[model samples]
Target: MKLMLKYLKRYPKLILLNILGIFSFVAVQLGIPTVMAWMIDNGIGNSDIAYIKKMGGIMLIVCVLGGAGTILLTYASSRISTNMIRDIRNDVFIQSQNFSHTEYNKFGVSSMITRTTNDAFQLMLFSNMLFRTALLAPVMIFISVFMTIKTSVSLSLVIGGSFPFIVAGVIIIAKLTNPLSKKQQKGMDQLNRISRENLTGVRVIRAFRKSEYESERFAETNDNYASNSKKLFKIMSFTQPAFFFLLHLAMMAVFWISSLMIDKGTLQVGQLVAFLEYQFHAMFSIMLFSMVFVMYPRAQVSANRIQELLDEEPLVKTPTNGITAENKGVVEFDHVTFQYPDGELPVIKDVSFTANKGETVAFIGSTGSGKSTLINLIPRFYDVTSGSIKIDGVDTQNYDLKALRQKIGFIPQKAFLFKGTIEDNLRFGNPNATPEEINHAIEVAQAKEFIENKPKKLQEYISEGAKNVSGGQKQRISIARALVRKPEIYIFDDSFSALDYKTDATLRAALKKETKESIVFIVAQRISTIMNADKIIVLNEGEVVGMGTHKELLKSCNIYYEIADSQLTKEELER
Candidate 1:
């Protein structure tokens, strides 16, 4: 409720309107009973036709007013609930935008989606009930109980006697459903995760002939979700009938006891009729309150899930009033060390290097040697565990995150393209890039031939996940995207692994001229890819074992020599 009120308070006028509607509705409900009793005792008993007509007309007017009030209440509740949910979803999305890989791993992608969408929807349903029925229930109960006793204190005990049973049942239902609600939500998360994995990894599943295994995994999760839902629905289904049974018993007792009083000549027939009306309203109000109680556990569960997401503070936070750099060309790693949040050992340890303007520095190593991790530090994707990384002689942490990233163009090993035209994806790197800059980037990345072959060329639409293009095409487009940025530093994390050797050589030669004034870093496995680099750094188990040019490293660095020996011919190695 604390989380709910934070958003509910934004619309004060709607709250006031809802309140007005509740009062009007309650007034009509209570007043009609009194008017009926008056007609029975004074008009019908005395044969006064005019009084009957007058009272009938008044009841009609009150009913019309009550209908208007119900309409107003519904409108207010709907507007407030929908708007509140919209605002909450927006905040969840904005908060997620600031999350790093650490946070993403903390809450899986499927769980986050459930929180933003399903959990928020639960809150909306609860809020709508809160504004419509929850508010009116209390007011109705208080007034109805007062009128019931005023009509006959002895008869009111029937209603009062049934109250404790309803309260006890509501409490028991709440307790039973609380744990089940939690399990139900978790089951939903697992179901979504399996479905997401199956859809995204369909190709791998088919290639490995694991389609049956994948199907079984998904079916198991779906069954768990369905079982929890079935259990929850069973409990709720039992509640309504149980409450009605108690209501009927109370009504039977009221009728039996009131008949005895009427025979004793102490209770008039009209008063007896009025008493029953109040009893029904009071008992019905309790049922409404019980519904709110039963639904509270599920809504509270959803609320906690949503609040957990909003409460999470990202491990990497942007500093206020961050420093700005004068030049963005030079890059330096001063004894940087980094460990994963859950790892037992550091992935990159005490590594240091510097690349001046107009230098091409390459990194080569066996898999899992921190090649990608080292480059990720430059863009502050993960901050160093101990030492500071400086760009243009300024500590990376000191610079504003956006300002720091704007200085470098980074392309990952696995190329990814959004669903859009070729030009749209290219413009993502630099939104204001000119046609001339785009054409130059395509030529340098060696993407011109394939793109021009397409009927629409730049306007050609790329499907989701770039499924329409080949591996090499995606890599070139990714490279061209970075080239369009024309930043001071370019870091390609094995971005050329998809291309043939000839294309790789041609692209690198073109890059030498295009990026002569900028700092460049490349991580590759092939010896020929980095043999022409100005400097090459050899890594082993996250440590920099060798730092020198290809020829120099072949003499001093055993790790470099072995890697080059594996991929390079005797003639290429000597060259």
Candidate 2:
């Protein structure tokens, strides 16, 4: 809630205007009861028709002015509240984006989504209602009290005694709802996580024939969410009728007590009638106050969640006096080791390697062998656990990330394409890349034929993630995207997996000529892909088992010999 209030300060002027509107609105609303009191006491009770008509007209005019105030302020406050939400939403996104890999993993994907959407929405709801009802309620309540006391001391007792009941009601309901609202937010995150998993892995679930199991998992989370919601509502249900019944009872008490005085000739008929109207105003004010309190608990839970994300500082940071640029195409890892944020064991350990300018270094290992992790270290995607990785003799930690990453081209195993044309996706690599530059990149990636054959060529529209294209085509586009920049170091992390043996052979052959000036690093499982490379590294169990040429390793390390023998014939492997 404190964080939310800080964001509200951005629209200080608008908020001040809104407060003024609420003040005027409450003044007019309070005036109505006063006019009614005057009409009933001085005009109707005395049987003065002219006074009654005049008071009625004044009351009607105040009601109209109050209505106008309500509408104008509602529109303005909504704009302020909505714009505030937009700012918060943008800030959360920027904060999350700035978080390091370590910090991001701590929150997880689904919880982050919940914070950005559900939590921000809760704050929006609270602020929107607070501007409209919060200010007016207390002011009207105070005014009603003062007006009743002026009418008479006995009538003030009629209204003020009921204050304790509504106050106690609000406090009790707020306490019960605070915990339930927190639980509700957690349950929502779990439900969102379940749904996201089901959508993304729908094929896997069906393939494994585990639909029933997944359905049960979803049902368990869904039921928990529904049950929690019902429980909170049950608690919340106490406040409203409890408020109405208590407040109306106070009004009835005013009527009851004032009636006796009227019969005794101590109070006039119009005075009793006026007292009844002020009693209703007092009750309505408390009802409005109770409504705002109800939203507070839910908003507080939301605010805390958002604050956690915003306050997280990225683990990776630029040094205070860090240099921005470095020599390109030379990478060295000295005793590098790494582990995922939550992993029990190290993924890569004590790995030492170097790839100099115009050299090709290939990492060949089985699945879970840390081949991709080794490549990821060069670009500083995940900071190394213990050792230093340097580019051009400068420690990676000392170089600004923007300058460090610009010299490297990275393509992940799973390709990602944004919503745009083939040209636009490629141009993402180099925004100022020319049309001829685009075609040359496509040719280098071996995607020229297919792209040229497209109905709209580079103008061919693509949906999000490029679902409109085939798997192999998406892979080529990703390659073309990376190739357009012609970075000093080109990292292909199992990039040739999707292409057939023939296409993979041709692509690698073309890359040799095109990438002569670039230091190429390839992580592949296929023996033929890295067989002719300048060097080959074999990783197993987080350690470098062997580092040598293909033939050199086949004649040396047993692990390398066994891997080569299993994939290729012993006669061919030995040769």
Candidate 3:
């Protein structure tokens, strides 16, 4: 409710109109019975046809006004609810954009999707019910109760007797369903997670022949969600019939007592009919109020989930005022060390290096050697645990995040492309890039041959995940994307592993001329890929065990010599 009120307060005029509609509706509902009672006593009993007709005309006018009120109520409620949800969804998406890699790991992707779409939708449904009935029921009950007492105090007591039972029933049902609703929502999150995994990993499952195992895993989660839904439905189903049974008993009691009063001539037929109408209205209002109680638990659960997302504070904080000074493309890692949020030990420890403009530096290490983690720090994907990283003699932390990232073009190990045209994906690096720039990037990436052969050329549609292209082709396109940016620094993290040696050698030759004025860092497992690099830094575990050129390391470092010996023949090593 606190979450809902924050957004709902924006529409004060709609709330006022909704209140007016409720009053108009209540006037029509209670006024008709009074007019009918007067007609019975004066027109029917005295046989005056003109008076009866006059009262009927009044009844028609009251209903017409009430109908207009109903329309106003529907329109107001719809606008308020839809507008509130739109605002909420927009804020959730904006908040998610600010989250760092740490925050993304904290709350999984599937859960965030559920909160934004499913949880928000639940709140919208509840808001519609709240605006339409939650306020109207209380007003109707108060007015109907007053009218019943004025008609006859003795009969009003019977209606009053049912109040405690209705209130108690509502309280009991809410308590019973609150825990069940919580479990149901969690079940929904798990169900979404499994479904997403199945869709994205379909190829892996087929390749490993684990189709049956994956199906059984998904079925187990689906069945749990269905079971929770069934329990909620059963509880809701039982409530309505039980409440109606109680209503019938109250009605019987009212009719039996009213008959006695009329038989002794203390009450007239017209008054008896009017009293019954008031009694029905009062009881019906209670039923409507109880329905809100029944839905409250589920809405509360959804509201809490949405609130969690909005309340989250990202681990990475952007400064209010950040430095945007000009950089000369000098990257220095001074005794830098880093540990993951949940890690027991550091992944990159006591690492120190420097690379200036017009230099090509390479990192080669065994698996689990922190090559990717080391480069990720340069872009501030994760900050250093101990020392500072400086670009052009200023701490990377002090530089504006956007300005720092704009200076570098990073190509990840696993290539990923969105569902769009080949030209569209390339333009992501530089939205306003010219055709000449695009052609140059493609030629350097070794992607020009395949792209030109396609029927649509640059306009060809790249399927989701770039599944339409082979692994080597996908890597080339990803490399082309980075080249289009032409940033001051380039970081390629194992991006050439997918390519054959012939293509790898050619791409490097092209990059040598294109990136001569920019700092380049490459992380590779193959020694041949980095043999011609200006400098090579070798890592073992998290520490730098060797640092020098290809020949210098071959003579001085055993690790470098062993890696080279495994991949190169005696003739190649001698050369």
* Ten-residue region with minimum lDDT total, candidate 3: 314-323
List runs of model 1 lying over 4 Å from the truth.
Answer: 268-270
Better candidate number, 1 or 2, judged by TM-score: 1
In what order do the candidates fall by TM-score, top score first?
A: 1, 3, 2
For model 3, state the Cα shift of residue 455 in Å.
2.0
24 Cα displacement, candidate 3 (Å): 3.0
Instruction: Please provide TM-scores, in order, for all candidate models, with all chains considered together.
Output: 0.95, 0.94, 0.95
Clashes of 3: 0
**In candidate 2, what are the lDDT values of residues 1-575, reduced to their tens digit?**
67867888788888887877887787787787678777877887789999999998898889888888887779768978898889988999988776776787788899999999999899888888888778777887888778778777897896778888788888888998999999999999999999999987888999999999999999999999999999998888877788778877777777788878878888876566666666677788888889889878998899899988888888776667777766656888899999887789899999998888888899987788999888887777788899999888999888887777888899888988989888889999999998898888888888999888999999999897576898888888899999899888899998888888888888888889888988899998888889999989999988999999999999888888888888898688858
The lDDT of each candidate is 0.92, 0.85, 0.91
lDDT of 3 by residue, 325-361 (tens): 6668799999999999888999999999899998999
227: Cα error in model 1, Å: 1.5
Q: What lDDT tens digits, residue by residue, belong to model 1 across residues 121-181?
A: 9899999998888999999999999999999999999888999999999999999999999
What TM-score should be assigned to candidate 1? Answer: 0.95
Note each model's CA RMSD in angstroms.
2.0, 2.3, 2.0
Provide the clashing-pair count of each candidate structure. Answer: 0, 1, 0
| Poorly placed runs, candidate 3 (over 4 Å) | none
